[model samples]
Target chain A: MQLQAEEYELQFSILVKRLGSWLSGQTGVAKAYVTLRDSQLLFLVVTKSTKYDSDFEDALSDLDIELANDPDLRDITLSVLSIPNVPSDSLSSFMHPTTNFEIQRGGNDG
Target chain B: MAETTVKDRLRLVERNHDALVALIEDARNPHDEWVATIAFYKAIQLVEALLAKRHGSVSTSHFRRLERLRVHHKDIYKQFRPLYNASMVARYLCLPDEPGSTSVAYFSSFSDYIGDAKAAIINGRLIQLEALVEKGLGEPFTKTRV
Candidate 1:
């Protein structure tokens, strides 16, 4: 069944919160920012890992699969970013400060 | 880091593509991980060339490049995502089991692991991506050798 607009929005919010909490618990994830752009949900993840690092890529692939498997998120155009690849200043113009997820104490050893 | 020109990126595309072709044709060993990794880099260069042509600059990071593709070139993004994931698996997760251990006991089945078949699949995807990028750029990729 197709979700109504309001119901979809509610689901999106819940999913974002759940994803944020889940990401906080992941290894190498420091902070994550959520934002909507061009009708796509973007997660800007800050990590100590460099681009193309094996563990980082593994985590990303896993996340991609997880999102794809979720019925609520399957149809949504979603993109996850590892922040090192994108400068924070460049993203700040579009990503609001309030969207930052609450990060845990010690998981940034990528 | 200095910004690379479209010409430079395309040159890199050719270099990586030729290297991929050479690796695939080697008779001694399949070199699955190297094949997959090279194919991914070839795809990256193709996307970077397109990005340079369209946006006047290439992305400095992999995710940023992916974001550009996702936002501006959805078709390419669809093709590129699988290539990226496959390369990740080939490079990181695909490991040889103990001498007497069954492959089924590991993270992946033997047939599903990064082997000749998976490398071929990655190569096919890279070719498809190359065609798409060439169409978008209105230029044929120069292949020194196939």
Candidate 2:
């Protein structure tokens, strides 16, 4: 069966919501939101507690659910196979998002 | 800290386009190392995030590469589908919680942004590679001519 990019994206989106919520519930992430960018999908599982990142991933693994990249399932699996740049502490998490407010990368839109 | 100029970024994009394509190929291939595969997706996400930050969105050719990859390798990339859309995932790590704070709140937040930026760049490169592969060299390119 051939699936279009958006089709894959839709399935992936549903999965993230189901899996992210499940993971959040298990890990105590009160408000977990899932977002899909093009075909790439991401689960922004938020919580009042900072340590929930690790727990969320762990819970996802525990459930044996993995994030998918539209058609690149293996790559998607690989993306999740490792520990993302999750913050271990507040201090480290503080420096997580770089201040690229006005600064742009590549410097070109075209 | 790219350690290079705009010209260098372009060169790097051109020189390494093939590698990025291959990375996605390997990532989509299940026979490859599981750990490496995940890293490839992570890396792509990082570059895409970066490119998106700079350009508001990835280019036409870049988006095409995404289409081709998705068409050929659905299962492999399925695990990272959310990161592709990545609306909320990035926010988990980045984004300012407080309204008025100029600086990001946490170190990890910065890390996520930088890492994601890298992913955006790499992901964007996938399309550039496709252009190079489909079209002959020395052709008129969108970002730069080959």
Candidate 3:
């Protein structure tokens, strides 16, 4: 029973929103977004700290466990970058995609 | 930006592989953190090379690379995830031991913190990945003199 492309996209969007809400509450995560690059889905997390501290690692480990346990998102790949790692132009590029969902600092939905 | 060819990616793979070998063979000090990091980057290059050769384009990011592997090459993905996690631990969490503190610790001994055993495990995983890459690319991946 293969899902239609539209149905799959809808499901993906719903899941991303739920994940974004969960990520917004996570400590040390300043922002999180999902973007399609080269036809592949990417979950990019931007941490508040410039360094990879214990808090960031804890949040990352928790996210990994959560993603692994989720049936739908277990197979999805995720990337975590500190604020310093993201280039200025790339941030805009990440936000350009319509499918992208960003949860900014202070839990502001973007 | 110019698109990277398979040759360019493989060249980067070779360079990282050479650096891994050099770091492992260095006699002065044992820095397992660096060893883990280099091994992971080498694996990254190998994956990128495979993607470029097979799909005609490399991944735009780390997660994209892993996603490409997960969808197209599950075996490589399985081998890569542990290496990725290990490197993250080595780079960020495995801190140096402090003196005479009797608190519960994640890693107690200096060896436990990215030690020889951990380094050996990471190396073994890297070799497994290289074998897979060689099978896919039909070329030798390890070019270290030692």
Best by TM-score: 3
Candidate 2 — which residues are off by over 4 angstroms? A4-17, A20-24, A61-110, B1-146
Can you rank all candidates by TM-score, best first?
A: 3, 1, 2
TM-score of model 2 vs. true structure: 0.28
Query: Model 1, B8-68: lDDT tens per residue?
Result: 8888888987888788789797776677778888888889888888788889776567757
lDDT agreement with native, every candidate? 0.61, 0.35, 0.60
Cα deviation of A52 in candidate 2 (Å)?
A: 6.6
lDDT winner, 1 or 3: 1
Write the residue-wise lDDT of candidate 1 on A77-109 in tens digits.
Answer: 566545332234434543555544432333222
Docking verdict class for candidate 2 = incorrect
- Model 2 chain B: which ten-residue window has the lowest total lDDT? B137-146
DockQ agreement of candidate 2 with the native complex: 0.06
Error of 3 at B41 (Å): 0.9
Better of 1 and 2 by DockQ: 2
Q: How would the candidate models be sorted by DockQ, starting from the highest?
A: 3, 2, 1
lDDT of 1: 0.61
What is the Cα-based lDDT of residue A11 in candidate 1? Answer: 62
Model 3: residues >4 Å from true position, as ranges? A1-110, B1-4, B94-103, B108-111, B117-119, B143-146
Name the top lDDT candidate.
Answer: 1
Candidates, ranked, lDDT: 1, 3, 2
Worst 10 residues of 3 chain A by lDDT: A81-90
